[model samples]
Target chain A: MALFGSLFCRLVLGLVIAFLFLPILIVLTVSFSSSAVFAFPPPGFSLRWYASLGKADSMLQAVWLSTQIAALSTAISLVLGTLCAIAITRGMIPGAKAVATFMASPLMLPGLVLGIAFLQAARDFGLRDTYSTLLIAHVVITMPFIMRTVLASLSLFDFAMVDAARMLGRSYPAALWTVLVPNILPGFVSGGLFAFIASFDNYPVSIFLVDVRTKTLPIQLLNQVEMSPDPTVAAISALLILGTIAALIVCDRLVGLKRMASI
Target chain B: MTLARDDLAVMPAAAPARWTFDAKALIAVPGLVFMALAFAVPVLMLVGDSFVDRDGFSLAGYRKVLGDPYYIGIIGNSLQLACITTAVCLAVGYPAAWALARIRGAWQVILFALIFLPLTVSIVVKTFGLTIMMRRDGIINFLLVNLGFIERPMRLVFTEFSLYFGMVNVFLPFMILPLYSVMRMLDPRLLDASASLGAGPVHTFLRVTLPLTMPGIIAGGTLVFSISVAAYVTPGLLVGDRFMTMSQVMAKAYLNIRDFQLGASMAVIMLVISAALILASSYLVRTPGGERR
Candidate 1:
């Protein structure tokens, strides 16, 4: 039984590893399929689908809108999350752990629930602006990712450097900038990148908040699949795979993937 | 992940904050107040909406959601899907995480990328990829036929199997990451000690490794269950109208039918279920046998 159990475990894990990569492999394969339809073992190879993305006016617009929301929300979340992290680390707030958990609670709740709540809240508040509402919702969606790493980084940070700097003659702000900022830059960078990606890919909350003009990439991509079953979506996925590789390279250089993944 | 961070939050109270209110602490207020307004108020208002409609304090929505068999089945579907996904993820991820924790150097980086790469790609893309691959003439069907496993293409896409398959794929990383983190901290010597003491592989695992990784199991389990229960895009794209989950019902309620009351009730139930799972998991961690690391 023990041997069986162990073998079973390995077999499942091996299959799972393949399971993780197979769809990605297939998507990459289908993108270059000369066949317009989603046929495996393509009739031939071509970049027609990749070329098609340029003229995919709606997809392009959605990408641009998603980019704007992700960047802005990430910037906003970094500031907000970093401040909260600092306060949690430096402050005497009782149940600061609970507070930290509370800050990250948005993640534990369902996006659909949050979307519904935001929908009702926006209507009740008479917040009619789609772009701003979507942005606000993205901020909520992005917050926990920011908080998790920033807090993790802050916990690992040595604050006595700031105190020593303060004792030497630097003002509090100057002490923080010189000592604290450089030390935690990795955390901020990792957190911000994760936050940006989270916001960019968000669909459920954005779905409720997005009007016709404003839609995130995930929503737009899903619409494309439901509307037009073609290789264009696969090409976009392939590009996204490349983008992720680029991001991974940047992360590996800046902070090392180990540190980023650990957090 | 939060387990260690919970310690981080607790560690600071020993030293400071007793002075005249540190102005630095005020920095946290903006985020807090923003959450209170943007996050808390909205959820509370949603709960309020569930209780009231055009008829000033009505249970009509609750009646429809809880009292109707169809809505009850939808709730069951979400729970069933979440339970199955969490179970599959745990079953598959535990050994992967175990093997991962034991790996060193170059191989770790390669495997890590393989697992984490999909996460970087959007869920829409991942789910879409699954749909494309599961199509009648998709890669999966083609391979199965070529291998003589089946005579011809099977209708695989809009089935319960694909729904579970896609959900497990999406959520497996979440399970593995937490388990990997926890398992990496285990002392290999402990396993050796157990073996030396005549504990067989099963006994060693159950008595030593299993006890040690309980927190990871809970943490990963809670995280997977919470997200999978409320999954929207996965079910919507994979199975579509063939299956009904709470999220789809809520989306239809709010977006299509504009039934705020029904959507709000659904949201409340989901929140309550998630909150219970979180609380239960945390409570498990805080208990004596499952003490925090």
Candidate 2:
């Protein structure tokens, strides 16, 4: 009976893992298919879809826009989140625990609600720039991710090393760079990676903030799926899969995937 | 001599170098100020808008959203979708998380990647992938027919099945990650001790494992529920306009209908529901001690 129970557990685990990977594998296979229309099996294999990605003018624009926003937001969140994380971990605030929770509270809110709020806020302020609105909303979207990992890393960090370095004639900023930064580098790398991905893939918030010209990639890709059924999306998705794999490889080397996942 | 109670509570005995304020605490100010401007103020404005119209203060928006059956039905659909998705995630995610925690080495890496890789990919891509896979002539239909489960291809896309399937597929990681984290921290020796005490495996699980992991279950369940309740993309792509979720209705209100009052009320409703879930879950997670933030 125990053996059977363990077997049942293993069987369920195997099936769930397969279920998770199935759609991704299908997307990859469909991306490489020579057939234009989606089908179970392709008539032949070709790089036609990938080749067609160049002529996708708006899609490329959207990709560039998403990359910029994601990069910018991740950068901003890392600096600000790390400092706030420092304050929380060092007991520098009166309600440190509550402050940490508040910093991460944006993650608890639904994206559509945030989107609506930002929309009304923008209107009230007469802030008509789509780009600026998207960027600002994305900063909020990315901050919690950075805060979570950075706080985890900071709590495990030893600040005495910085104080020791300061005693050794190093300046405060210099001590922070030398002693503090390297110890928590893994958190920064992993947090920044996750934050970048969060901003990159955001849809609900970006949906409200985007104008026709400023549509992010997820919004644009969704529009394509609605307007036209084609492999160009598959081509883009395939490239993104490859990009994600490259990122995973980098993160695994720097911080290890297991550690990153734990955070 | 005369220490303020709030200040005393804030300062732990180990870190008692404070009376006015810790100058280092100012490091958090920029981020706090940013959140106030970007997050807090806007959400407050949304709440304010829900209670007002163009000319003056009004409850017309709430009357429309709360009174109309169509709107109420949409609210019901969102809640139902969220509940089912959260329940499914917890069910599937528990064993998966347990297995992940217990597994080792290469297979563990492989399994973890399978979950984490999809998470790294955009939800749009994942949902889009599901749509393609659920097409009449897609692999799912092909497998179903070939495996003798069905006779012919069915229109699987734009259906409730696809919506739930796509939602679970998208949000399952959020569920699994929390459970896995908690399970990793659980001591396997406790299970061994339970068995040594002559407890049956079922009894050991129920009395020992389940109680310990309740926090994880609550956290993962609430995480999935709150987020999925407000999900716009997965349902939008998988089911389109065939199903009207609160988010879809909210989107239409803002973008197409030009009804900020209606949209703000809907957003406020979502906000209140999610806030209650988050608060309840955290409250439930509190230990016999003060809390575990």
Candidate 3:
């Protein structure tokens, strides 16, 4: 009975893993297909779609815009989130746990609702700049990821190391820079990666905020899928898949996948 | 001189600490203020907008949402879908999460990475992949037809099945990760003790393991339910106009029709339902045995 149970468990795990990976594999395969339509077991294989991606000016612009938003928001979130994590973990702040929870609450809220709320608020406040509004909204979307990972890292950190450095002729800020920074660097990297990806790939929230002049990659890709229904979007997805693998490899190298997932 | 120096060093430590606030706590102020202004205030205004219109404060939006059968049907449909998705995710995620908890080393890391990889990718990409695969000429139908299992392609896409499949695929990791995390912390000795006490594996799991992992199950369920409830992109792409979910209605009202009042009310209703379900789940988990360590 136990053996049978264990076998069943393995089967389920194998199937689930396959389910998770098969779609991505298909997308990658389809991107290489020479066929214009999305057909599996491509009749012929070619890189024409990838080559055509260069000529798709709108797609290129969207990618650039997404990159800028993702990078800037992630950088800003890292700084603010790290400081917030430090204060919550180290300082004798009242309602620290509540503050932590509140900071991370955006992760739980639906993106559509957030987008709607932001739109309403933007209108109410008379904020007309779409670029600045998007940057701010992306920051809101990205901060929670940074805060959650950094807070988790800080919780496991030993403050005595910082004190120990202070005792050994290093000033307080210097001690934090020397001891704390190196220790929590993995958290920063992983958090920043997650934040950047989250911002870059964000769709529902970005959809409401994006104007004709400024559209993100996901929006552009969706538009392409709707308009052209070709392998071009597949090419983009395949590239994204590669990018994700590289990011995961970096994350695994910095702080093992196990640690990254657990948090 | 040595004794005087020792006294001076100790004096700094022994002096009554200034009752002034810890300035380090101020570090969180900027983040707190940002969330307050950008996140909390916006959500609050959204809820407030639902209650107000050109004719002063009113519940007309809610009345419209509730009184109209079409709108009411959307809410019911959303609830049903959310519930079904949550149940399916938990059922499917359990065995995999169990396997993940029991394993260690490289295989575990690889499996963990595989499960989480979807999360890093865009939902649009995943849904698009599903769209390609679920179409009449897509991989599944092609396989089914070629294998002589069916005479012709089946109507798989733009159905409830695809919606459920898309949602479960997207949110399964959320369920599994929490369960796996909790299960990994299980003490082996408890199972041994249960076995030695003459409890069968099933009996032991029912009484010991299940009870202990209830918190994880609750956490996973809440996460899955809330996400499934608010799901827009997958449903939008997969089912399209074939079905109407609250998310679709809300998006149409707000974005297309520009009915902020109607949309805000719908948003508030969705938020309330999600919050209620989550609270109910947590309450159920907590009240049953209270929280185990």
TM-score of each: 0.93, 0.93, 0.94
Candidate 1 — number of clashing residue pairs? 0
Model 3 Cα lDDT, one tens digit per residue, A1-263: 76787788889999998888767888998999999987767899999999999998998999899999999999988888888888889765788888888898888788889999998899889999988899999999999999989998899899989767766767656777899989998888888888999999898788888889899999999987777778889998999889988989978888877777666
- The DockQ values of the predictions, listed in order, are 0.57, 0.53, 0.57
Deviation from native of the Cα of residue A206 in model 2, angstroms: 0.5
For B1-293, candidate 3 gives per-residue lDDT tens digits of 34334433665663422222355567678888988999999999999999999999999999999999999999998888889998998898999998888888888877888888888888889888999989887888899899999999998888988888888888899999999989999887888899999999999889998988888999999988898888888889889988899989888997799988999999999888877876798678769483475
Interface CA RMSD, all predictions: 6.6, 5.6, 3.5
Cα lDDT tens digits for candidate 2, A81-142: 88888888887777888888888988889889999899989988999999989999999999
The segments of candidate 3 whose C-alpha lies over 4 angstroms from its true place after superposition are A164-172, B1-21, B288-293
lDDT of each: 0.86, 0.87, 0.87
Q: Give the DockQ-based CAPRI class for model 3.
A: medium
Error of 1 at A96 (Å): 2.2
Better of 2 and 3 by DockQ: 3
Compose the digit string of candidate 1's lDDT tens values, residues B144-231.
9999999989999999989998999899999999998898899989888998999998798888999999989989999999999999
lDDT of 1 by residue, A14-104 (tens): 6778998888888898899899998887899999999989999988998899999999998888888888888898754667998899888
Stretches > 4 Å off in candidate 1: A1-12, A92-94, B1-20, B290-293
